[model samples]
Target: MKKLLFLLLFFPSLIYAQNKTGGINWISWDEVEAKMEKEPRKVMVDVYTDWCGPCKMMNNTTFSDPQVVQYINENYYAIKFNAEGSGEVTFRGTTYKNETYDANKAGRNGTHDLTRAIAPVNGRIAYPTIVYMDEDFGILSPVQGFYKPEQIMPILTFFAENVYKDKTWEEYTKAP
Candidate 1:
């Protein structure tokens, strides 16, 4: 009884803190949208397939960076979405799903409609795309590729600070 009571008192908080240790608090699309309705915040969507190598590397490095994690948590609702995974999402009025997904082909299933909608780079789909969006799900950019912590920080801050509003990325990065 005492052990049960002790766990009930502390286990949840411990797990919550542990999850935040060197990791971003990745929420779902539904949750992010719901939260945005009540309290608007920027969003970062990590669209990747499970079999993507650079995607795994990004998860192991950039997303794990302490500074990156803290800054994203403070200013954005981060979502780690699987590009070829099962799920239904209704975004901007239309519903999306992996209609061509074959359970036997989990690793290389057809792309989810949500991924098609959010992660195309110049009309091409790429693994490990990092999409940034405004408070109302308006896409700011769908930057595709793997990046180290140092490489991603500037991009994160560019959106976080609204620098993209006044200056183009080239101009912003070129300035001293």
Candidate 2:
């Protein structure tokens, strides 16, 4: 009777824990550089503004998806960067900072220099951009928008496995 009661009480929680994604192991930009020296891995930067709704949605949904979390944790160094943050980040001998940040503002604050450096789309900053970089910190791509787990798996695999080298995206997607 006690065993049955214990199982009933704890089993649901155990199942929930197992089903839930453990979430990405995010590192700082500085940590990525440091880690690269010892062991190189692809880097995926999630550039988001705090005020952006889609950014929040992506964080809660797509980023927390089990498959997405597992693939990213296994293949890349994940970074979560606030685009409007005022912190200084030094990368590849260059210092990036948000000099024009205004705390009093709502919706849009000043942009971080690192955000500009990574996700520059014709001198504009977009929320929820995913920046992919090579092991050496070279830019591979900057994908903007909120992507579901199903939507993002292909992108993750393409970069993670270096499938972009020989196969075109069209070709890769068509493959059985």
Question: For candidate 1, lDDT tens digit of each residue in 1-176?
Answer: 99999999999998667655758889987888889988899899999998999999999878877788889999999998989988888788898999988889746888999998889988999999999999888999999999998999999999989999999999999958
Please report how far candidate 1 places residue 47 from its true position, in Å. 0.1
Error of 1 at 84 (Å): 0.4
| Cα lDDT tens digits for candidate 2, 1-176 | 99999999999998678656467898998788888898899999999988899999998889888888899999999999999998999988999999999878887888898898899766667889999999989998898888988999999999989998889889999958
Report the number of clashing residue pairs per model: 0, 0
Cα error of candidate 2 at position 124, Å: 3.9
Off-target runs (Cα >4 Å) in candidate 2 are 1-21
Candidate 1's C-alpha runs over 4 A off are: 1-22
Clashing pairs in 1: none
